[model samples]
Target: MHARTTTITADPNRIDAGIADVRDNVMPAVSGIDGYVGLSMLCDRSSGRCIVTTAWQNEQAMAATREAVLRMREHATEEFGAETPEVREWEIAAMHRLHPAGDDSCARVTWSRVDPATIDEVLDVFRTDLIPRMDEMPGFCSLSLMLDRQTGDNSLTAVYADRPSMDASRQRAMYIRDEFRRGLHMSAIDVAEFDLVLHHLRVPELV
Candidate 1:
């Protein structure tokens, strides 16, 4: 699968309204498009940072919708009164969910870089050593890893049942995160927490 993400840093107070616009307006318009699979949104209210991602069945589908998607992104930025957003495209390297998220669910995303030459080896380690350990964490909901194969850049998002559970599992989650970083010889670029703003997709499970 392929995905496109638009990241906007907007007015903190208006984040929810922006999310609503996407949920109630933008999504409905695009959900029926050819090859559209799913859409997810994440918001950090305190920082006014929001990330919206839409998934497609193939690169061609994603490419075909680029112009329309860009317009939607611009509309979102305008609605949120935010600066221009940053956009990216990626391949869905991995995805697994134990359950669907409830309203209280939250997520953490880590952006990093790995050696391009050893990407496959890194992915194997992630599946075998990291995911299983993460699954044991309390409140764990799901995890998806996205990759920019050309640049060796990657982003991983892990969902938790609720804010309290996410906070409670912090220490152990950090340990595992650090272990993964060290083992993969990866460089951490950015990490942030977000509320599960909107998740209205019937995306299939991939293990």
Candidate 2:
């Protein structure tokens, strides 16, 4: 599967309107396009940062919708009273679900970079080492890893049942993340937590 993410920094007060536009407008339009799979939205209300991801059956399908999505993105940006958004395309490298996310679920997202040549090895480690550990965390719901093959840029998101569970796991989560970083020689770029406001992504389990 392939995915495209649009990151927007919006006016904190207008986030609700922005989200409504995506949930009501953008989603339905994208759903009717060929090869459409699913869409998810994550929001950090305090910072007014939102990330919207749309999944497609393949790279071609994702590419084909660029123009259509461009317009929708512009509208969303306006609705949020935001600055220009940053966009990226990626391959869905791995996905695992222990349970479905609920309305109160929260997610922690980590963006990192690895040597392009080492991506396969990194993925192997993620599947064999990281996943099992994450699965055992209290309230763990799901995890998805997305990658930019040529650039070796990747993002991993782990969802928890709710804010309290997510908060309680922070220390252990940091330890595990640090361990993974050292073991794989990966460079950490950024890490943020968000309320999983929209979680309709239906990409099949891809461990």
Candidate 3:
């Protein structure tokens, strides 16, 4: 599977309107397009940062929607009262879900980098080592890892039942993250937590 993510820094007050537009407008339009799979949106209200992602059956499918989706993306940005957005394409590397996310769920997203040549090894470690640990975390809902193979840039999003559960798992999560980073020689670029405002992404389990 392939995915595209559009990151926008919106006017904090306009977030709700932006989200509503995505849910009621953008989603319906995108769903009718060929090869459409699923869509998800994450928001950090305090920072007015939102990430909207759409998954496609393949790279070609994703590419084909670029022009068509552009107008909608621009409209979303305008609805949010945000400036230009940042966009990226990724390969769905791995996905595992213990349960579907609920309205109260939240997600922690981490962006990191690894040598492109080590991509396969990194994925192996993620599947064999990281996933099992995450599965045991309190209130875990799901996790998805997306990779930009050529650039070796990757993003991992882990969802929890609620804010409290996500908070409770922080210490252990950090420990596991540290160990994984050290073992894989991965370099962290950024990390942020957000409310999982829209969780309809229906990408199949890929682990």
- Candidate No. with top lDDT: 2
Residue 82 C-alpha lDDT in model 1: 98
In candidate 3, residue 14 scores what lDDT? 99
Per-residue lDDT tens digits for candidate 1, residues 1-207, read 889899999898788779888998889988979999989899998889999999999899999998877677888898888999999999998887887888999999999999888789878987888788888888999888899988899999999999998999888888888889898899999989999978864556654
Which candidate, 1 or 2, would have the higher lDDT against the true structure?
2
- List, residue by residue over 1-207, the lDDT tens digit for candidate 2: 999999999999999999999999999999999999999999999999999999999999999999988889999999999999999999999999999999999999999999999999989998999999999999999999999999999999999999999999999999999999898889999999999999989999998
Pick out the ten consecutive residues of candidate 2 with the lowest summed lDDT: 177-186
Q: Any runs in candidate 3 off by more than 4 Å, and if so which?
A: none
Per-model TM against the reference: 0.97, 0.99, 0.99
Q: Candidate 2 clashing pairs? A: none
Tens-place lDDT per residue, model 3, 1-207, is: 999999999999999999999999999999999999999999999999999999999999999999999899999999999999999999999999998999999999999999899999989998999899999998999989999999999999999999999999888988988788888888999989999999889999998
Go through the candidates in order and give each one's C-alpha lDDT.
0.88, 0.96, 0.95
Candidate 3: TM-score? Answer: 0.99
Q: What is the lDDT of residue 12 in candidate 2?
A: 97
Please give the distance, in angstroms, between residue 70's alpha carbon in candidate 3 and its true position after superposition.
0.8
